[model samples]
Target: MSTDPASTDPASTDLVSTDPASTEPAPADRARGFEAKPGAIGSPPQHYGNPLHEQRLLAEGTAVVDLSDRAVLTVTGPDRLSWIDSLTSQAVAKLQPGESAETLLLDPAGRLEYAVRLLDDGVSTWLLLEATEGAALHTWLDRMRFMLRVEVADRSAEFATIGTLGSPSLAPAAPNGIALHWRDPWSAVVTGGHQYSTAQRHPSADWTYSELLIDRAALPEAAALPAAGTLALEALRIAAWRPRRATEVDERTIPHELDWLRSAVHLSKGCYRGQETVAKVHNLGHPPRRLVLLHLDGSEGVLPVHGDIVLAGDKEVGSITSAALHYELGPIALAVVKRSVDPALDLVVTAGDPAIQIAAAQEVIVPPDAGAEANVPRLPRLGAVRR
Candidate 1:
């Protein structure tokens, strides 16, 4: 059967027991089917009761999400800024204290390894990620520390995260002190980045949510906001054309394919693990794939699951990564399609044992022609004569 239309847990995630090394404790009573999360750790319920209403609360900036299942780490010491700057896609050496920026960890091939939500509060730079990535990310950063003064520690137990739309001040500070908030930079192009999505108004241009680093002691209070779940947040994100770490990224994923450079990449940034690939794809070659929003048909009451093969007739061109029933847009999804797929072709989502396939119209996010050519010279052929 299709996921419970009434069910808010669209991801249908499973619970991941807390590891002994994890600072997190066992999940609370309200947490059950929420096991299907970005990091696989059990989180609070998809919604206290109503999902649509809860989605409203989250979108209107009146709710908060329990991000404890996600992880938080801190980078401390003097070399933090410069060291990080030398390794990521963003310019962080001059990051102002308390300001928020995002960065991506890519392989030398420019394929995304991880993306971080960052905030530097003078004392320490906080890195927030899905629970699944915490250990590996921490270990990777620690190894890269080398002789630097930076220190990496898992802060999940000491600090939890709460996500809300709009300004970081949507809620009051925790009893201990004001929580550090990392504002999302998706609304516009960052200083040294460029946008590949040609839409006059990018969907994420309306994104204003931030993840708050709060005292874990405030879990109850933070999760208290109308009891919305990841489903609610995911719907809004999908509608906004936002690309997430888990669903959108694959082993071959790069920032350009999803138009992520609008905020997460800096074209002029110093060298990092994947700088060459980033520059190469942007300047010399086009991304192998492009991102698109699929306005799925929900009349059958079936929503395509992630990994559902997308076809333009019989040939598989892509697959759906994220799908949701938005409050305003109804059922919609984000898919990574072949860069050469005809823009005018009708798309279909193929999934389920019965093989329920639904037709989808393409709302192109990244066009096939997207690439970098910073003053690329159009050299004439040696034997060609001017007419």
Candidate 2:
């Protein structure tokens, strides 16, 4: 699909600029950096509770997160169902009211452009994607419309997306036994006592007490709202072992490499651009690497940044992609380690403090027909061989 670079907002650009104020300061400025500004990279205001830590707290308690960084696209038309199903990996045509699915929009080369959560509100389907790739996803969908009887528009400015986390007692109950209500990633149950509407536009109109919206000029005020930043969110994801599009994926990464096939890919779906490669990798080949979670020995020093190597003595087994300190779990990280490594083996993060420690990541099992093979990489022997 053809993308117009001019369509993006200036503030949303991912490229680090040369502006003195924007550039990361030197090592001498490390201590002062946190004190410098509230919104600096790796440093958000304390009110937000460190984006890395907030995600964990949100899971344990009630928290409202500003997901304005996600881009929204609205598709409406008589043929919208067919149009979307032909492009994505999920069965979009069959999505019932109030249901959502995570799907991928792939490039011609089978690489991912953006992974999105699609919410179907009966009338129109909303595609929520990473804020950084919003414009690109919009343009790609628009260009693919060609002669299809569907209309796709970027509605990012018109609607705001916020994430709410809490217990069944804290969130409003869902109607009609539809226990799963899509606010974003987490599901909410609308209680029988309250007459709730699943309409996105009327989110505030019906859910009086438990609703929030995060926009450019507007921030919702609620008792459940936690003051957290990106770092806290990263930490929580690490604890849950949830992967993000940026830290866990790139052009070289495939869906199975990060175990995305579990949620994002549908094996039974009809042919799509990247279906062949996905099938080949699943049935005939193993993912070159695998994603794993690491518990760092924080007492050693600071955690390493993304792409830092993981070592088994002199051998590089993997690289750390995401890391954060959890209030409960301590310094933890997510890494794409070599499948060859034994999950029980101890390893070391080669960045930050030399004394940092990492244990084998816990693995979540995938379904048999999903195409993952049993012939995974084995970890090297650390001690004396018996035979």
Candidate 3:
């Protein structure tokens, strides 16, 4: 359905004027947020702007994101904190009122199930995740609650979560400091608290990265806020190198492989499902792959697609998971490279119309005693263990 700007704001000059029937579809449906230009692959509808461009802007300036596509769940009761802490990767029990953390739900094998942002709002806790998995995650969490006093309810339909990308000064104010910065790329600011199924349209309202909870009755008012489609959101995500559940991770992907352990996994927290795998991988074995940032030499051609092979010399070292023509960084991407691949070596993505050149990611090193030395076996030379 076409969005009505007048229904949202009588004073918005930024609204694009068009006749619903006469508006020919652009190469990409700039309205819904898809990158489906004539020859491009179909993508989710757009939200605010190009999510990738928004992410780049967020890094250099500020941008708003519509996270309505993200699903929300509410857990209430005195035991909410303790109950949730027993399930996810973060130390949810230690979070004070108004605090938030980024956490993960893992499968039995320690592979990722859902990555979420947990917000403690004094009386209840909110879990925000990608909308695609909201229902399943809610059911999973509900089933896991055996004797805990907490009540789990899927609030996805009730709340519309928005995301803002930029520094704190540009973000909306929260009485309890900027809604807790759980990871570098994410923050959670409660919009409607426990208010269920509300909607409202606010002309002056900026729905960028802020989650706005409105009752269904308030949808007209909520639509008043600048509406964004999904394409813009995707662009923003790629720019930040932020990985989502379905696009970047799958059933066999571990938290460490996605750099999630740095932000989502609490190294000192008590046990939870898959904790043993986390501990074993972190303490004993080297993760098979590592997520890295790629600066594609745009001079070649368009960006590559997911699963595109990354080559170093003639050896395959990694595969690209996400790529975009970043407004600021040219063609940039995120890739999962073999942990054994030398960081100094130059790589190339073999996917785009013309191969895109890739540079090694900036390596973040660990202190000497962080854990046992990584156990990636060295490649044997012609006849010796030496290169």
Candidate 4:
């Protein structure tokens, strides 16, 4: 019943009991009716049969969303922080233990490659990301650790990620002498980051998102608690105007295009792989495209899907990246459209196989004038004499 990118199939491997303390696998594995999220990342339940209710409970901070499928990686050794700081878009060389930071790994052209949620425990730096990004990110990081006193490893098999709208009553597992909880930083602008959204009050102001890492063996118990599905999580994410790397990004995606600078990009950070383009775009040029939230018309009781064409009149301006039926918002979506599209104009989205046109009203996320924050004064025309 849900179309989230995180819902589909059944997990191939059974999350069986591995606790040395108990011989029985936690009953949660069998009782929770868990199914594989889309792309078969890991078997996570889509819902507990009532998505709307689950959304309500999660919003109330009484529910936990199982995110076991997400990939976890660890960087250890003396150079862990500085080594990774030199590779991503955040100034995390001095990230303190227990601090949370979000960063973007961009291609040489400043296009997004990976979005990493980071937490350090003094002994190790943890990288939490989408399931699909684990292998590639691990491979790349491992390759880049040439002469540095650091080491990287894919720790997905050892730990699982559990998401909560806020700190839940149950504490996260402390496997390696540290509570692996990561508080999201998207609610406000970071120290060296910039905000592109001009909203008087950003929806993320109340987004108290946090992720907890637990032993994979403990999944059964965590799943047994008050639980919600990925569907509910995706809906809330769209409403908060939060961007996800797996859904909001494309080949041409720059952090500025998604208002990601507010949390992920450090405008004054030292050189990195894509530093030149990031600097140029923020100082002199506008990103070619921007992100928007679509208040979709749900009159037909239909929700748009990823890749659905978004249009202004007859011209296709962009495509829907993520869409969902929010608990309170009816139907909503996040789309990436040309920065030139007038924010005042209502748009259309065509969904389904035969394609039914759905009217969508735009809620600006990234404005048309999002970049070139340097405030360079405009030079007058040479031929025209000054008055």
Q: Per-prediction TM-score, please?
A: 0.87, 0.69, 0.68, 0.89
List the candidate numbers ranked by lDDT, top first: 4, 1, 3, 2
Q: Pick the candidate with the highest TM-score.
A: 4
List the candidate 3 regions with Cα displacement exceeding 4 Å: 1-62, 166-241, 352-387
Best by lDDT: 4
Candidate 1's clash total is 3
> Candidate 2, residues 1-387: lDDT per residue as tens digits?
111212222222121111111122222321222221212213222223133345545655555544444566778877887788878665567877677677776666666667778766666777776656677777778888888777888765654445554432323223233332354332222211111122243212222111222332333232234434445455555655566786777667767666666556776678877877777777666667777666655434456677778887679887877776655655666787776776666777776444444433333222122244435676668895766
Positional deviation of 131 in candidate 4, in angstroms? 0.6
Residue-pair clashes per prediction, in order, are 3, 27, 48, 2
- Cα lDDT tens digits, model 4, 1-387, are 232323322121111101111122223343453332333444466665566777888998889987787899999999999999999999999999888999999999999999999999988999999877899999999899899999888888778889998667666766567789999999899999999899999999879989998777676677567888777788788899999988889898999899999999998889998999999999999999999999876655567777889999999999999877676766778999999999999899998757788888888999999888789999998898987
Q: Which residues of candidate 2, in runs, are more than 4 Å off?
A: 1-57, 167-218, 222-224, 353-387
- Report the lDDT of model 1 for residue 206: 69
Q: Relative to the true structure, how large is the alpha-carbon lDDT of every model?
A: 0.76, 0.54, 0.55, 0.82
lDDT of 1 by residue, 12-61 (tens): 32211111123334334444332233333455444455556667888888
- Our tally of clashes for model 2 stands at 27
Q: Alpha-carbon error at 59 in model 1, in Å?
A: 1.0
